[model samples]
Target: MADHRAALRAVVTQRMLTDPAHDLAHLDRVWLIAQTIADQRTNQRVLLAACYLHDLINLPKDDPNRHLASQQSATESEPILAELGFAASEICNTQHAIAAHSYSANIPPESPEACILRDADRLDALGAIGIARTFAVSGALGRALYDIADPFAEDRVLDDQKFAIDHWKTKLLNLPAEMVTDGGRDLAHKRVTQMLGFLEIFSEEIGHPLPINWKSV
Candidate 1:
């Protein structure tokens, strides 16, 4: 079991390192944060593994073939896990966790490890790292930071507008509540607060000058 787990980790690490969007450094950060939280949890191994591998398959939001790509990767992952001799249960759990990590899917994770993995994945979308990734993704899609008005909102349409800012308002800010383990919640709350503060400063800077009295000491 130990050897199989190690082999699986190697495969995930290699794949993530090669992936362009969610690269190795991103996976490493998530795993580091996951370890800090998982230390207090019962299923650290599962959570850690899921954290590193959750984004193994990167799907571009604007790609017309996005759904097909995700399904294909999920299908491929099962065979890879089977070849690695991972237990059926562990393979299923890991796959489910990965599938649920997508923003569009919105599937509820089944286990504490899954929840922790999801939170860890989303945490990468906040603060400095998140800002870089957001613009990277936006640039790739040829999107400006602020569209004149919400393009998709007119049709009561679903679009990236909500996905972009809501990362700050919803998942990033609400992470403390969504976190499954106590330690995860504690650590997440601090980052969430930092992200919120960053957003506040960002909005003020871009929108207008603050009054002299409103300036901090």
Candidate 2:
């Protein structure tokens, strides 16, 4: 199993795209986070495999097939798992975890491994690193950092597709509320606060006066 992990790492190194957000560094980060929250009851092997292989395939954020990326990644991972000599049950469990980890997939995790993977990966989208990943994707997409006219989207309908900062109001701000475990939730709240602090300062810097603590729209 140890050798299999090494081999799987090699496979991903050879195949993963140069995606700035979902790169090998992202996988390693998620893997490390999973170890923190996972307990003795869960299958570390499946969770570990899912960690390494969840983003085995990457897609552009705006790609029409973005929602299908997780499913496709699961489909593509089967052969790789088999080649690594994963047993049938373990492969299927790993596949389930991978297929369901995407935010877009909306597939309820059926196992502890899936929950840990999803929770940990989503955590990567919340903190300072999350901000870096968001801006990286935005820059790569040639997106403006924010809408000058309505930087906080107070009156306008939030459209992240048009601006990067809109993503905080539309998605990132909502992550702390969705975390699945006590540890995940506690860390997420801290991260969310830190992110809001950044936004508050950024708003002041941009002279937008966008209210970071708006109770409502």
Number of the top TM-score candidate: 2
Q: What would the TM-score be for candidate 2 when compared with the true structure?
A: 0.94
Residue 68 of candidate 1: its Cα lDDT? 50
| TM per prediction | 0.69, 0.94
Per-residue lDDT over 1-217 for candidate 1, one digit per residue giving the tens place of the 0 to 100 score? 3665567567777665343457777877787776666645436555555665666566676666565543354555777767766678877777776676655566777776767676677677755777677767666666665423432123243345434543344334555676666776676767666665665676565664323322221
Write the residue-wise lDDT of candidate 2 on 1-217 in tens digits. Answer: 5776687788899999998888888988998899898888789888888999998778888888888899889989999888877899999999999998999889988888988898899999988999999999999999899988888888799899989998888888888788777778887888887887787789889998857454222
Error of 1 at 153 (Å): 12
Which pairs of residues have clashing backbones in candidate 1? none
lDDT of each: 0.60, 0.86
> CA shift at 173, candidate 1, in angstroms?
4.3
Off by over 4 Å in 1: 1-21, 39-41, 64-72, 147-177, 207-217
Clashing pairs in 2: none
Best by lDDT: 2
